[model samples]
Target: MEKFYPEFSARFAQFLEHIRGRRIAIVGHARPDGDCIGSQVALARVLGTLGHEVLCVNPDLVPRRLQFLVPGMRFARTDEMLADRTDYTAIFVDCADHARAGERLKGRFPVVTGNIDHHLSSAGFAEWNFVDVHSAATAEVLAGMFFDNGLTVDAQTAQGLYTGILTDTGQFRFTSTTRRTFLLAAELMARGAKPTEAGFELYERETTGKLQLLERFLASLRMECGGRVCVGTLPNGIFEATGSTAEDTEGLVDYARCIDGVDVGVLIEERPDGAMKASLRAKNPAFRLDRVAAQFGGGGHACAAGLNYKGGAAGFREKLVAAIAAQIAAVDTPEEKK
Candidate 1:
């Protein structure tokens, strides 16, 4: 076997030794996506087999699409785990920053044991921060680490890790998907990861309400920056109107980005409480959407990023457009012209 993560695997061995006898809480970000939930489950199961007591914790409930990975497992939310008082050593996974787990969770676990992630903007916030920006997903980082360190990955863990890679790679169609990703997926299948089942759960389970929501999103699409950018807005209360939830916004932005000549796609969700949430996806990694999201205190990979802000959507939209537009102009203009 080729050592998938040779360097990180050695560090992982030290991490395993560091927390040998401690109870662990695998904390994930709020409004958990496939990668977040998948990484949490995969890590929890692996650690559980090592005679370590482990629990999965998240700020929000596992979304519908990712529920398959959590069978027979109970996830502790903010209140449940905070009241347990188990003295859990926090191991944050797939979170770019402390705030990604929500302010309340961050306050509870100010000090962290380990942080494993693949986001380009990941902040090294833990004692053993294993971040590989080149990996397509945090689960990929963990899978590599586990395989390299000779850790056991049962059937369920394989599915969890496989789902993380599948979703984060845009179903293996995104530019981030690499040879290692496919090779890992193949190995995972040999270990009992079912691609057909995962595909059905993640994609084929879309409801009529979700289609309605997508209709609204498509209708709201507006081309900007001379058609190079496609922006869609979901108005406040639109979820109620469409009979859909935030999770339904999952792949809506991709429709915008897949269009011809559109370099970037955006989905801006307006909240009733005056907070704004935006999802940014770029066809080209050169767009560095993560940097654009960082300007607003959000972060992720270069091609995909997101942000949450406390303000009117319109005001935020203007600022976001200007930033993205500037990025576009920088690429368009010749260096000598400047």
Candidate 2:
């Protein structure tokens, strides 16, 4: 098999050697998405097969669509795991930083054994970090590593990996989707990953409440920066009114980003406690929205990023628009015209 990440092959080998017989905690980010949950499931299953006692940990329950992937296993929530106080070697998957796994999880497991991720904003906060920013998804990185190292990737594990790649690449529509992405996906299919099943479950199973939430989000869209940017908001009480939760807000920002003239899109969610969480997406990678997210101490890929703020949604919107508008102006500025 072709080694997509040659540099990390030996490191993965060493990682396997270190955790062979140890109790392992496979941690994923908060409000886990397809890639995050998929990486956790696949890695936990792989490690379990190798004689390790593996437990998947997350700050939130698996989203409805992803629950099917972890049928026989259980995801140990941070609160419950903290209650147990079991000792394990912590390995973070799909988390850009330790805190992305949630403050409590990071606090409970201050020392990390290994980190595997594909986000540009990853801080390498572990003893061994395998971050491939070029990979479309963390599942892609793990798939390549497993194949290269001759590890067993069974049908269920393949489904988990395939689902991660499928969603993270927007069904191969994102610019981040590369030839290697397609190749790895094909390999996974051969290993028993049913795209028909994954697609039907992920897309065709949307609930009426989710559609109501989407309608509300679309109605809130506001154009900025001469229509080059679009922003929307989900007020604190909107979730209750629409019978939705934060997970239902997933992919809502894409609607703002996919507009023809829009170069960037934003989604702001107001919490009950006056805290705001914002999701940012851009059409081009050069926009480096990750840096924009970093200004507020959040992190993600260049094209997609997020941040949290301790202020009202309106104030955060003003600050975020100004930052995004400044970036647009810089991009429009003529070099020699100076």
Candidate 3:
């Protein structure tokens, strides 16, 4: 067992020491991806082994594909956790900001005990913030730290960590994937993570409606920003028409980014409430799609980010396209930073 993340391991020890006795709540972001859910499952299992009473809470229900990671009522909805009288010292996993867990959960835990994440845009929001932007996924950081600490990683926990790494790395095809990423994944495999099942469940299990939904999304794709970017829109009620849920939109933005000469890809989902959710992806970090997203009160990794906000007088799609175009313009003209 090598010390893959010695410094983070040390901080994890300190985090454990700080919340030694109080009941701990592990909170995750709304509409959590694999990284969010995986980190929550891994942290809960790891902390539970330490004899601490732990609970996992999320603003949204676990997506269908990720249901395997949640075992036997391990996760609770925001209202469910709030109903419990037990006071919880919260630890946020894979959340870029304290508000990433949504306002209600943020209200539930006024004082954050810890936050573990790997998003490039992550701010140190918790008392014990363990944010390693270099790590491909927060689960990668946790897996390395858990191994470095000589902690136990059961099969389910290993599966969760592996899934998080797999998804966040774009199946190990993203630039963030490194030798260390592969090494940690191999170690997780040795610890009983089944890649075949993870891959099959995550990828091969797509429903027909998801396929139709993806078709609609791709059909809406248009080249924007002088062919440097591709944009797609999923209209409100498209989910109902296609018999799909919001989770089916996963990986749709990648198709836009895969187009030739497109430096950035955008997906704007029109919600039923006149609000919008957008996902941004870039072929290069210099495009700084996260910075583009930050303009709309959302942030994430440099190459990948998202935001959910109501469209204003200017229109969200028009505004978002302008922001992205501006980002590209800045990159195109290096002298524009002023």
Candidate 4:
């Protein structure tokens, strides 16, 4: 409201001047989602247009579906690309915290020149931090920055920005979706973003392997807490059996949340490291899923959050179920009585 962070434009101008003609590394968070990749590519396009050499670096390959939005998004193996970060200006995007950039990159480029993100957990990790958690998407913040700085938004830039907004807001269906989000989407469309094509590519272009993986995940869905919570797990073996990758499981958590009578959805993805990554989503505004995620050292928006647990996969699942149950119990507790 009232134009969150009025000084962002002026500060961004200063950052641009400082990094002109420099070899810049645009880093996104690990296991990047659409918002992460979109913000990175969009910002890279702007930086490149300003006569700066920019490299968009992500630890994981761009999701096959998102590749169409940011064509040829530059990606690098973390161990190889960040081995030496001596002469590069680091700019992080859509990451909540410094650690989200991975320890290797964080160690190499300790001095972050800029950060662009919309998560509340971003506690000013950069010399020039642009964290506006109020904004619906980091792409919304990026779009505002681009317009404020008089940067021309072309097809490539528009596509990237639109993708960031779409995914972060769950195609504008999430509770965070606001009038300003739609206004930003319209602005991006006017700048040549093809929303129709993007919708089909992102939502409709899943491969058979991904579909099978989803089927398996859905098959494992469990309803608990008198059907108020829905839980699903995607084991590593399921990916192998279905010939799917981590990216294929990206939005599968939403499927569980979409079921009737399920106010909270829990998705646990078993990782090769013997750990599980838990993504929690809420259908009811009364639910505070971030609190559930914080039990495992993660924090995010109320409606969406995640946690990483180091334990046997089964043990992690058991712990997560208990955590979710505790959250549900708290919701039913009377405030005054407590």
Clashing pairs in 1: none
| Error of model 4, residue 125, in angstroms | 1.3
Candidate 3 clashing pairs?
none
Regions of model 4 farther than 4 Å from truth:
1-7, 83-86, 334-338
Error of 4 at 138 (Å): 1.1
TM-scores of the models, in the given order? 0.97, 0.97, 0.96, 0.92
Indicate the worst ten consecutive residues by lDDT in candidate 2: 329-338
Give the Å shift of residue 300 in candidate 4: 2.7
TM-score, model 1 to reference: 0.97
State the weakest 10-residue window (summed lDDT) of model 3.
Answer: 308-317
Query: For model 4, how does the per-residue alpha-carbon lDDT over 275-337 read when each residue is reduced to its tens digit?
Result: 888899998645677778888888777788898887566567777778888877777788812
Alpha-carbon RMSD, each predicted model: 1.6, 1.7, 1.7, 2.4
lDDT of each: 0.91, 0.90, 0.90, 0.82
lDDT by residue (tens digit), candidate 3, 86-179: 8899999999998999888988888898999998878898899889998999999999989988889999999999999999999998889999
lDDT score at residue 305, model 1, on the 0-100 scale: 94
Q: What is the lDDT of residue 113 in candidate 4?
A: 88
Model 4, total clashes: 0
TM-score of 4: 0.92
- lDDT (Cα, tens digit) per residue for candidate 1, span 1-338: 78888879898999999999889999999889889999999999999889888889998899988889999776999998778876989999999988899998998899988999988988898989999999999999999898888889999999999999999999998887899999899889988999999999998999888999999999999999999999999999998998999889999999999999999999999888889999999988888889899888788888999998885666688899999999888777787132
How many collisions between residues are there in candidate 1? 0
Ranking by lDDT: 1, 2, 3, 4
